[model samples]
Structure formats: structure tokens, C-alpha cells
Target: MCRRSSGYYAPTLAALALSATLGLAALSAPVAARWARTTSVAIGAGLLVLTAIPWWHGVTTKTPLREMPVHGNWALPGEYEKIGRKLGAAVEKAPVRSAGEVGALAYFCECQVVDKFSDRARLVERINDARERSWLYRLNYLMLDTDELERDRLKPDYWLDWRSGPNVGVGGWSTTGVYRGSGHFELRPDRPAHKPHPDDQGQLPSQASK
Candidate 1:
């Protein structure tokens, strides 16, 4: 289950700045002392209130956050959780590959989860892509975060193929095909060879798309 924000996690800098009100008021010209103190406290209060809205909404809405922008579709997150539990159960007492969706499966499956792309390597690669792009990508990334990504040579087996495509109707997501290795085969193995719908295409650009 996804946890709703209680706003306790929000930064309290504005609340902290409230402590400076008395000092700022005393240092100001006497005529403007009250004005400065009042304005400062009001602004800080406003920001604090603004930060509380998400928490209030969380208190109101019982809906679990559900979204999948990959294919512009919606789904209950439980669907994905179900798939994870199912996969874990299938490989009972053994380690299996995951899409690095989350840590819950790792705990439930009682196995070490490592499917590449989940660690610093992929982050470094994306940062490289950012360096070659506009400021938007570079905004939150630093080139010095890591040296060039050293490829992890550990080959994966029994890979999770939970991309958007044919849905087995188990979960809301399209078929989560467990392809051998990372071959990224596009055609649904259960179906005939044909171009997948534009939305169903989730293959990596470096690998075969169809």
C-alpha cells in the first residue's frame, strides 16, 4: 500500500525563520518595526499553510496513488503488487529477476534483487544523456556524481517483462512477459509476430524494439 504524505516530511525552513521575527523587528527603524515583524510572520505562516494542503488532502482522499505514464494509462497499484507477489511465489525459495519495481518483493521473495539499471550505473548513464541535452536534464544532475558507468557484467536470467502489451488479465498492466535474458523480444510470445501497438512498445532503444 502506498503511504500518503502527512506533510511532516515537508521542510520546516519557513517555520524556522519565524524565530528571526523578533530580532528583525528590533533591528528595523522603530516606525517599521511592527510592520516588518507582522509581514515576516504572515509570509512564513502562509508558506506553512501552503505546505499543509497536501497533508490535508491525504487526510481526505482514501484513494491509493495509481499512475503509469509509460503508456498514458491508469491502474491500481495493487495490480503491480499482485504481479510481484505472484512472481515471488512462482520462484519459491529461489532468486528471480525483477524490474526493480520496489523492495517489497525482495522482502517477500526472500532473495537478493539485482536486475541492473537499478543502481548507480543507470544513474550515471542517464546523467551522461543529460550532459548532451539541455539545461533541464542538467539541472538536478552533476557530472561528477560518478565516473563513466562501468557496465555490470553479471548476466540476468528469468527476466521480468512487465512492459505494456497483451494483458493476461491477472493485473491491470499488459502482459508481464518473463523473457529469457534481456533479449527484449517485442512480439508477444503468446501471439503471432506483428508490430505492437505504439503504446505497447517499451523495449529499450539499444535493443530490438519489434
Candidate 2:
């Protein structure tokens, strides 16, 4: 959200600047009053249109929501576990160096979590705890950090890409990314027993050991 002062003053400043330039032009020579008025009107209209285009585009475009492929029985590699554990430990450390520094780190950590975890419940729980002690701006950071952690753990062999757009019901917009495994992991036709399926009988799919 735009802060009150900047949002209120920017347009006013722009108008003042424009008016000052036009006044100087009028003072330099005996320009017709009609000509000065026309020029000012044209400049104001141009500025309005230029500023409104991005807002209009955002309202009109229906951005697509992209989903990453869910892998079956994906193993959390030792390296992933190592990194996750280290990050988790660091996050749990007591009393950051300063409130400002804590806030910044918390913000970054939340993004990492979201990029890693996505929508996992367990990870979300852990992130929620971490966020509680963080600054208010850092709340969303927790959700994002959990997402990142999950993504990294589930697909260690792949790279993910993201695109930005509006979010549903969330007022503001956000970026969503897709991730796929590299050649190191290929799709198996025989779906793993532990895989989450729409029509699974009561059987638990075999999970890969971390």
C-alpha cells in the first residue's frame, strides 16, 4: 500500500512542477493566454493517461494461475535436509541483533519459506510460529518462506520460474511460479503408493526416506 504522505504529495508535486514550467514560459514572452491554457491542458491530460495505463491493464487482464506438477514419493535429499535444518535453527535463534535487522531478516526468511514450502501444512505450522515473534510486515514473509522450503525439499533436482499477477480475493497481486524436475528425475507411469491421489482407497503411499 502506498503511504499516506507520498501518495498524497506526488500528484501535487507534479502539478506544481508543471505549473511552474508553464508560468516561466508565459513570463518569458507575451504568449497568448489561450495558447498557455491549451498547453497546460494538453500536458495534464498526457500525464493522466500515462499514469492510468498500468492501472487499466491490471484491471482488464485476466492473468492465469499456474500450478507446479506434484511429484510422487519425492525424497528429501540429505543436502536439502541439511539446509532446511540449518535455516530452521537460524530462524529459531533468540533476540535478533536489532528490531530493524530482525525485521529485514524475517522478511527475507518468510520469502524463502514461501518459495520452498508452497502449501504444506507442517511447514506452514513451523512458519507460523516463526512469524509470531517477527514484525508485522514479516507475517506474509512466513507464508512465502514455507512455500520456498517445500518447493526446494520436494524437487531438489529442478529449477522453478515465477510470474506475477493479481491474487484472488486478496486485494493486491502476487507472483506464482512453476517448478519441474530436471533430467535426474523422470515421470514414472506406475504412480507411487504414497502419492496423493484423488481416488486412493485407505492405503498410505510409500514415502521416500530423507
Task: Provide the TM-score for each candidate, comma-separated.
Answer: 0.46, 0.28
Which lDDT value does model 1 have at 20?
A: 67
Predicted candidate 2 versus true structure: per-residue lDDT over 126-165, tens digit per residue: 4455467666526556347656654545321211111123
What TM-score does prediction 2 earn? 0.28
Name the runs in model 1 displaced over 4 angstroms.
1-9, 12-31, 63-77, 117-155, 169-210
Candidate 2 lDDT (Cα, 0 to 1): 0.36
After the best TM-score superposition of candidate 1, give how far the Cα of residue 179 lies from its true spot, in angstroms: 24
**Which ranges in model 2 have alpha carbons more than 4 Å from their true place?**
1-25, 28-31, 62-90, 94-104, 108-210
Candidate 1, residues 80-159: lDDT per residue as tens digits? 45645665566554434444344544554455444444344434554566557757556655545545455542333344
Q: How far is 33's C-alpha from truth in model 2 (Å)?
A: 1.2
* Model 2: ten consecutive residues of lowest lDDT: 95-104
